[model samples]
Target chain A: MFTGLSAFPLTPIDEKGIDKRAFVGLVTRLADAGVDSIGALGSTGGYAYLSREQRAWAARTAVEAAGTTPVIVGIGALRTRDVLNLAADAQSAGAAAVLLAPMTYQPLTDDEVFGLYEAVTAEISVPLVVYDNPGTTHVTFSDELHGRIAVLPKIGSIKIPGIAVEEAPGRIAVLRAVIPAHVTIGVSGDWLAAGGLLGGADAWYSVLAGLFPETVLAITRAAQTGSSAAAVAASDRLEPLWALFQRYGSLRVVSAAAESLGLVNSPNLPLPLLGLDHAARRELEAALVVLGLN
Target chain B: MFTGLSAFPLTPIDEKGIDKRAFVGLVTRLADAGVDSIGALGSTGGYAYLSREQRAWAARTAVEAAGTTPVIVGIGALRTRDVLNLAADAQSAGAAAVLLAPMTYQPLTDDEVFGLYEAVTAEISVPLVVYDNPGTTHVTFSDELHGRIAVLPKIGSIKIPGIAVEEAPGRIAVLRAVIPAHVTIGVSGDWLAAGGLLGGADAWYSVLAGLFPETVLAITRAAQTGSSAAAVAASDRLEPLWALFQRYGSLRVVSAAAESLGLVNSPNLPLPLLGLDHAARRELEAALVVLGLN
Candidate 1:
């Protein structure tokens, strides 16, 4: 019965380390915007870059800001032990669920993939979501693979990126046909929000929710109430920002947007990823202003 | 100065976990092939797929088999702390140097990349090799960035993959000109051996060395002695297997070749990576036989 918009808030960091006050403020704003859930340590949150201590702090801040709302902690890492450690830390932070992606470096076998989930789920008491974002990680959870993973005892949901946006509905249908009714299917693309809703996605995962929470919430509300016209209108208004996300990729665009919104001090990405170019930054800033967010 | 051929030996896993006997045997065979050094836990050795305990055991086995020769341990991971821990373990296991790939997963900034190396080198006592393999890790070390990292204490070498074969000479030249003369540059990819040597690479990071150590040693010795005819003869003999490595990709081709030579019991890969198809297996087997390796 998970529905509506979920915000993936950026984990703020400065030279000294995790900026807890800034993180708490961002989460408070997200919750005030009517976000149904907050997903911390997601790619937009720079989960891969943060130290274990930073991840725990971000998860705690999200839960504290959420008050009664659920918090889903991202536990994606190359090592299963690290994932399990994060999962346990999330539980200690009172997160309602854990969102996990498979090991990023080595392409795992189907059995090893299953074992990864099984091992992680075995360590934590919280509900688990099999987060499938193959573009960043270079690994995909096929519909067949999803079917097999769905049967795990605590696997309550899936956060699938619409890599093939057009075929998302068919993919959703295939997943829905396999998973039990209790397990919710969530789509992770802004463009596919309308289609994901019409195709029976229970909720939408929005990176935009970090900077434009109210707008994302409004869209989800309209979609849930079956107000197709209102939903389309919201989607149209947000399409420009989504286009920006598509341009430089979500992780970079979302981080930049978060910085503009004053949710975080700087878009400090870890090693290997450069900051946005001047043109991309100006483009993002213009989009934010257009959306009345900057 | 580092020279000759290095073998990245596969870690053996059985029902009881890491098969020490199998691993020891594999390393012993590589030693018999007269490999200059033994590399443990690399992509070909399934390093990322291993648990920390398994990795430690593999390192220990490699050290034991290596005897007087050096054992280079792969210490790359998603988390900085884990990499540090692995480096410490590797040093204790008597590994002569640690091969560190910059943080995997998300793209990183140059500062953060430098921070990772600085942190590893600060705590670990052994020499470190900066491994730049963008194909697997999705990150590359630019010459400018390499120049910055090279200044760090204990950073004694670099291992650059030969996919960018043409670019090897320029990179090696830059490193040789900038870094200390003692810091050797090792080249990966069998086909790039001649080019790499001509480009001033000091050593061959040879996967083929796992199967044909003598061949690799002969080629390197010939190249060092300025015997072009002998070097070409060796390269021609091993060219088919190297071509197969390029076609099927290094990890798959190496594992398939090892299985064909009865070095590894199974051609099993961890989750997400499908094993070689029958046609690929046949081609690999034929290539190995052609090279007189099987």
Candidate 2:
């Protein structure tokens, strides 16, 4: 169900709770820009840090705001029961699909990993996206496991993390070969989106799309049409923003960029991850000007 | 406030939830063995996988069963507020101290790391142990951050992950030099316990101690008395068990060993992490026999 340029918005939170209005506005903008899908409460959305209630609210708010745009809500947690609970909540909140990441405190065996997604998929009617973000989840989706998960009932897509810009095509090729033809392969990580699209990923599950859906959609369209020059130019234009992503994570940089562009209020992200540093903020401002984001 | 060999029990859960009787019995056994402290919900206890309510119950149960043995509760979480909430729960449950690991979803800066603990200590009356477990938390405690955390007002101990068995002594030496003398330096990860104790660490925050408290105590006492050969012999005796640890993490192996010894019922650990594999079980059985645990 998740395809093309899906925008994963940073969940903007204020002291009172999730800034519902800000979140709704963010999703509405993406929908207005005609993005393919909306992924709320993904890593960029801080699903891991928010309470269950807040996450449900995030899903509901995004879904209601996006209207016709399909919304994929992240349902990953440290426990299986928790993931199942969140998956059920996502369905009730009208999410288009629920994303599952094998996020466990202990190292999960291949069987155990499959069983986690299988258990959740059994309960929910919505398609499940196996989020293969090894960096955060600490679980590697071996090619074999990918094939195994792909065959399970309700397994719709596998969201692969993007490799270096140049390596995306090769990574996509290997994944496409292993996974069944019907299973959509989406690529995440804002910096990896252009490469992922050019490399033949079924979709770009993007962070930058949250702020600049038109820019990401342009890159996706250019790459999909085999317009290599156009895709390269679009990718090069965002190189400065990608530099900010390298210095800090996309989540921080994206939040700062959005704040600088006056697209949203200054967000108070969950603690232990502070706002962008002064140098980072200044760099973001310059990049925003250069990219005409402001 | 915390020192010596601290027994960290795996919070055995059954279908009915935290096997309360089994949990209390295990802590009682540690107290009966005259263990210095009971670390009820450390990583080995599966704190990350537990619900807040379950964790509070674990703390209260261990503290009540521990009698005079000081009880330390693990209060790590992805968000600072959740950590504070858990810390408060720990205090109300009569824990002697709270262990805080910067268990964040995103990479935390040193300032952010210190801020998390600082926020917790400001509210709680109990001491805090800086849990520096990089393997799980994904946040490294630079030596500078370690020194800064050690000097915090209510910080009592710093539980450092034991490096490789051979590297334990040097790791302990470096940590000891940076952290103040008053703040206890405790080493966890059973494989490095012997070397940690011998290298002048104030305590061995141990996993095996939860089951074989006397064995761990024997090793600790041996090291404390300058009996290096005896300590090495004691550690070497458990090499087979350590091999199991190398294969599967301590949480799984320790839970399996406990079940094999009939110390607790066969635990239904939180999913995505299964019980020990057959090979691991057989190896654990042989190790138990060798160690006279069976």
Candidate 3:
């Protein structure tokens, strides 16, 4: 079952490939900070850029480091068979769940998208989280499709994109109406965490949580405890850091933030995704200092 | 020295993995049909979907099948080091050239893009083709960047998106002026091939050429011979097939067309990219008959 702040850490790659020591360090930090789960190979993990072998290695490393904590591995790819292959690997490596994103080169029809998840779910006994990150995957899920996939066997959760903070409550309510109560509804996109939690999202699938796990968990706890003002105050302070995420991607901002806080060895965002520019790094440092993260 | 109708073929994969027999069959067919060059592992080849090992295997198969015909292998990836590694494999496989597309998950700046090519060209002895496929790579080469990259040593050619048939001549002329005389300027997007040839593009980097080489060569030859009327007539007859390419992607339409003609086992558009729909297949059949390719 997926709940609470699940930390999605960046997979650090040095010259030797998938720096196991750096990865173990980050995952152990999050586990020790008391996050509910560790989501490895998420977009922040650079799943798309890595070779299948590298990804599997990263997953194993994260799971081993996570100890008693559940590890949810992102298992998205272009092919149904490949996704199935990854899911099998994830299940074998002791992952609690495999996240599916229906990532395709061309636009997929709803039926085709459903077929992908159906194929993967049938193969893996582990629970599935339908990751609806349309921004990267380019495959948007309709409410009808959501309701359809929600009832599939071993489907534990659905990580929906963050709605506007103002619309988070209504959006959560609408999804809850159709999706079965058993399916945990988590919110992604770090900026919308407090609003989504306040609006009754069961979990926050977080990027910042990888580095600042206790801080993120604190915010989630405040929202869950019905401390509205406390949650609002916490979310308000994170706005500046979130601005860096909006300017550059969350992947870039988070990598820089982690390095600034001495969580990761280097601010090396894997290739294609460059590290933050000098000015942006300065801005991130200021935000981190103000938030008492650095 | 890339020139004439260079065929870009799809890599066939089945349950057993990269269908080596099928790939060899397709590449041999293209070589027998007298294509000027073989562009193995290009976009239509589904470069992104394949593993490094599979890609190297495909390149080797294509080169051996191509025989004397120049084989250009696509060596694009998210990381500069990965591209370099692929380029080394392509070189070892006896490929005549390696095509580099600055394909990145994150948007790359002009400097970062240049740095990638510079890093690649420094390592390999073979010429590199700067692939500017904005549709997939999400990285566009400015005219300025194009002119800048043209002068790099061993940078033999640039595969540009095809312009409209009517605008081909002018576009080719403009590029030819900035790009050196020796660097071959090839036009991709098969629908724009005839016009690109007529407009004086050095070669047609064609998808249809993979399946129907002589037919495409005939059109290119006609244009080369200054028979504009003949080239136009040939392109006009294939408009219906071009319509399918415009509606779907060239990868899908070309794969469908190739399969319908019995050139390969099936029009198996790789995963993430589905095969043609029933209605589109019907429409393709009709077009093939009219063009005498069925």
Candidate 4:
């Protein structure tokens, strides 16, 4: 039911734990920026580091702050039962929909992959978005597999990452051609929004929108209204931020950007992933200035 | 404290849930074959396909049938918490040791990989084996990371797969040289046992042992007891089974052999992975006949 720019806010964490105030503030800011929807516990939100209980709390907080805006909660886990559990929690917390990724470590055969989605979708009462980010999750769904899974009942949309910028349009075309008219396709990058929209993606799942939400919203509105010049202008201004986001190549980069914007106190990532290095921070600062986001 | 040939038996499943009676029978048969230990719910044992509750039941059943012989429970999972929980269940069920692989799916940084193992090992009270099967897990423990994790208390062994045959000796040497004396380096493969043992591996984890445990046990015992002639003879006799197992490049072939021997009925695998094809089944039967197991 949601459209336009959907901002996936960076989860704020400090030495004590998840900074609830900062997270709530972030949700409020994105809502004011005209974000069509907000997503929590996504890759940008560092869902892998959060406990199930923490994820549930974050989902609730985001949904409450989002008010009338649709809140899509990412429900990714390695096991089918865990994913189902998260979906139930998200549904209980009043999330509008749940974004699901395939099992991360164990590569499932096409049949197994379809079966996993079927199992998860069957358990949840909420609308589902089948997230395809094979770069992080080693397993990828083929076009045929995606086509089969799209026909399932509860699936509402497909979220495809924009890293494969050139391939994304074709991928989106394949998905659009197969999935019914009711199903929407969302792009997960800023730089490819113009091309993605042209290729049939219904909306943008914007990470940069967390920092400059209005700019992305304007671009999405312009693109949807068939104003090519307005969409290009907006995309041009956001390109620097998009490049910076790509430089770090990890989820922590989004949090680092949040810290740079003073939206969060620290870029303190959970153990295992080190915070952004000095060079990366400087690059981010330069890009922020270029995009007028600093 | 146990060593030599260890067989990870396939979990039997007929139309009626888990075929516990057939599983117990298979264990009893392996015990009679002079197998030194039993590995349960491991990759070969279809741990990924079984539900968590089913996994616990299988572990318990295997432990009950194992008696005094050591039972090494496989505790691999995508999240550290799940692995820890599995380890606790395994310890409570009386498993002798726990074997775990690193987080798969997302390409983990070296630090994340090490952190995952440390988190699981810290919580486990019993001895644990770090099972490094990069082929399936898509993540490898570098020699440096292995050395760091090997120092942890209760860390007892390393299971290096045979695909890295050439590197096995060097890796074993590094682990042996750096880790405490109590930490054993073991190799998993039918043909690499002799070289691995010669290169200082303390034991072997063999799939062939499920079908021809006597032959594998004899070879390992002969090698351990300094009977080169006996070891060579035993290895020669087990060659056909090894060749058959390698043909399909999957562990299901081993399960098919178990079915051929009447150890378990119906080698019906879970969704995604089909059972042995016609040619593979015939080859397994032929190999079993040649190995005198028929």
Which ten residues in a row are the worst by lDDT in model 3 chain A?
A265-274
Candidate with the greatest TM-score versus the true structure:
2
- Enumerate residue pairs that collide in model 3: none
* lDDT (10s digit) by residue, model 1, range B1-294: 256678877675543366677678878887777777888888777787677788888888798887877889998876676788899999999999888987466656676688788888899898998888776787767778888888889988888878454776677777678777777888887787766775678888877776567777888888878886778677877777777777767777776666776666673454434457799888877876766677
* DockQ sort, best first: 2, 3, 1, 4
RMSD of 4: 4.7
For candidate 2, the per-residue lDDT at B250 reads 84
lDDT (10s digit) by residue, model 4, range B170-254:
8677667877877877778767676566556788887767656776777788888888667767776767766765666446677
lDDT tens digits, residue span A1-294, model 4: 646678888787653578899989989989887788898877778787577888999999999998888899998876566687899999999999999887544355576678778888888888999888876676677778888998898899888877364676677777778888888989876677766765667878877677668777778888888887788777877666667656655465677777887778864565445567788888888877776778
Worst 10 contiguous positions by lDDT, candidate 2 chain B: B263-272
Ranking by TM-score: 2, 3, 4, 1
Whole-model lDDT, model 4? 0.76
* TM-scores, chain B, all models: 0.93, 0.96, 0.96, 0.92
- Candidate 2 wrong stretches, greater than 4 Å: none
TM-scores of all models?
Answer: 0.75, 0.97, 0.92, 0.79
Question: Model 4 chain B — which ten-residue stretch has the worst lDDT?
Answer: B267-276
The positional error of residue A207 in candidate 4, measured at the CA in angstroms, is 3.4
